[model samples]
Target: MARRLFLHVGTPKSGTTFLQSVWWANRDALLEQGLLLPGRGVNHHYWASCVVRGGRQVDTIPAAGLAAWDELLAEVSAHPGDALISHELFSPAPDERAEAALRRLEAVADEVHVVLTARDLVRQIPAEWQQRTKHGRSQTYDAFLDMIQKDEQARFWRVQDVPGVLRRWGQGIPPERVHLVVLPPPGGPRTFLWDRLCELTGIDGTGMAERATRSNESLGLVEVETLRRLAGTLQDDGMPKSTQRLLKDFVAEQVLRTAEPEKIVVPARAYPWVVERAQQMVAELDGQGYDVLGDLAGLVPGSEPIPGRDAADVTDAEVADAAVAALARFVRHEELQRRRGRRRPPESSLRSRVRHGLARRWTALRARAGRS
Candidate 1:
């Protein structure tokens, strides 16, 4: 059995991707130091979480197979040292499912600790809207905010309600063992969050940040609006979820993120409501006995307004410009693939026959040269 198990449930859009990237990149080094990141790949934990939660599938992602949960548990049980399981998807699990997962986790380790990382709603709101776009949802930013505010069942609150998430996942675990790591406001050191994780887990994370290669890069306002439009069209055409996922991975992450358009930020009109909500969350978290690693005051947004145009305010001209740039990028990528011969040639084309003939002749020449 593992000695200690750290389950990092998440408040999404709070630097979870960067943390996971660093941990996965340094998994071998961490293993030598007695901290085990179980499973075969970076996304293994996410798939396992899906299985554990009754095969609940996230938008556009396929459901994990029934064996995923068992495989993850097997890895944890086999590890002799501390093990960590992390996924933002684990945050919003229903109460019974969350309890079931905790029960299984508790069976494999001497102690179970629930870790949550969170940032202010002022940032999370817009980020969550953009995330929905990536998942092929076409809901406008205004509609997303309205849903989250008015609907208790909004998916946003399920994951982003810091105090609520802790209460749900922290059940049955000792309050002191449940950890909340607050993400500091922007402009701090890049390694600050990693440092916090290391401090909590007692693992040496030196230089791990340099090794991390993945980031959940945010899209600019125009870029995201363009994606939202594309998503709506694809959904109308009944595009396969797998194909949508590919577009999100390639076009959104690779092409759209390179644009320099203005970023999405909370509208000035929403500041009062955002501030009030943040204060309420901080007040609730203050009373919770869970161990907090950073200042609770950091959860509250600042009085000064954040600068950036609302996503809804993005102009048609801006979206057109982004779309044209993305199209050009796709063309360039296709040309590069053809040049590198990564793309298959048409089977009936003269070019294909010539290429095959050249390949056979080259082989014959190599054979003769070797004999000589």
Candidate 2:
């Protein structure tokens, strides 16, 4: 059995992606130091968490399916040293499920520790909205905020309610074994969070920072608003979830990402409530007696006056400008794909032929206009 198991359940939008990227990139080094990251791939923990949460649907289960948790347990039991399992999706499991999952981990290791990395709600709220938009959700920012603030049963609260998540997952584990690694406020050193994780997990993360590759990119107000509107249109047109997911990735990563980012901030009307909630969370976390790695007070929203346009208040003119910019990027990307021989073969259908012909003509017109 593993000597120690660190389970990093998360409060989403709290640097989870960056930490996971660093760990995966340095897996070899970690293993050399006797820290085993069990399972076959980067998403191994994700699938295992789904199984523990009782998710058996085709969409939720991975390729190896519902047996992922058992596979992970077997790997941990066979390993001789420390192991870490991480996934933000694991943070929201209810009390019974959370306890059961912990018991399973305890069975495979001599010691089990629950690690939660958290950030202030002031930053998390808008970030969560943008993340949902990336996942093809069409809810307006106003409605999203309203639901998070008023609906305790809202899915957002399940993963993001810091104290609540701790209460559920920390039960029965020694307070010292359950860690609350507070995410430093923005504008500090980029490696601060990684350093904190290393301190808790007893792994030397030297040179691991540069190996980190993936980040859940934050979208600008115009970009996110455009995606939000597109999501609504696609949903209304009965687009398949799979196809919509592909389109969402294309638009968010390829097209709209080229535009200047306009940071999303809490609107004045909602700022007070956000601050109040942050204070409540900080108070609760402080009282929980979980081992804290950084300042718990950092979880409170900072009072600095930030300047930016609210996503809920984007104008039609801004949307139009963003749409045109994104269209130009899309055309250039398609042309590049064609040049690289990556474009799909032409379809035989008349509609496909007509569309291709129109595209060729548009390219010809643009070339002529450039020459003139």
Candidate 3:
């Protein structure tokens, strides 16, 4: 029997992070069951990055990232049982890169299955906009949607265009080997997707649900608008991109993540168009006859109203309140650090203080002797 490789390329925000976290956390158990999940962390994202940027002179492509694929393959080849490589970034590969990636995988494994986790565009669109904001993008929701419509944001469509993503990744591979896992709609079973993924891979993640500590949380209208304003200020002041990343991370952990947030929704006016596009994609997928693990109807956008303040409805006052709250949190964190610092003064500083006091006492004694 030839070694089997299961690839879970993703449409982001479809619980990929949680899935990867579960797999990484339960690595020992998975290995005991004859499955290999090889990576320093949850997934080999760097390898996917390299594959997408193949031979391009991009500064983000590091030597280690480029070599990650080879290192992962070596580990897979050494292990006799099934191997799983997952990275959502891999789903965005253009035709050329996707073909090349598959060719490389075929050389080492006799059977390679392509997996794609999908959700309706109506839900995905707003989430994608929020994701960009977290990454330092300051575009308004209106502009974000417009940019996607115009295909101005290459990365957005690369990961989003479901049928296109499948076509590229599933090229030269049988439709039977191409698996589509449609995410359950809102209010559906939370564990449905995980259960389906496990069934497909023959990996048991029965007790892994409790291990999800990290997730990409969505932002409320006011919170996201406030962050956008901050990003704009940073840009206007010529803040370095690296500094922006630091600031974003600090706020994400210290302020935004601590607060309860509302989900962004597709405006009612835009609903029909979004649903129409999603249906078209679903039709395409059905026509292709790929093996779908979940209900195809799940791909249709739900009519339930998403409860939250619309992006357009966010008021300047609300944004100001959010900004002030963020500043207060930051100040409180700084004050706590200051208190901790005073309680634990460095040894060098303590020694310096002692030397200064002794010197002052000796000088006073000498002056008194001169006066006598």
lDDT of 3 at 70: 76
lDDT digits (tens) for residues 221-302 of candidate 3: 7777767766665555454545455545666556655466766888776677778777888888777979898888777887
Cα-based lDDT for every prediction = 0.80, 0.80, 0.74
Least well predicted 10-residue stretch by lDDT in candidate 3: 349-358
- Residue-wise C-alpha lDDT for candidate 2, range 1-372, written one tens digit per residue: 999999999988888889889899888899999999988766788888887777443365547856778988999999999999998988878789999999989899999999998888878888999888887788999999989889989988898888899889988899999998888888877788999999888888888989988877888987788777766655554545564456546667777785458888888778888888889888777767789988889888866536767675776556656666767886897799889998566743432332333244345445554665
TM-score of 2: 0.89
User: Tens digits of per-residue lDDT for model 1 on 182-296?
Assistant: 8888876767788999988999888878998888988888888877876765565465556456557876886667645577888888778889989999999887798998888
RMSD to the true structure for each prediction, in A, is 11.3, 5.3, 12.0
Flag the better candidate by TM-score, 2 or 3.
Answer: 2
Q: Global lDDT for candidate 1? A: 0.80
What is candidate 3's CA lDDT for residue 203? 77
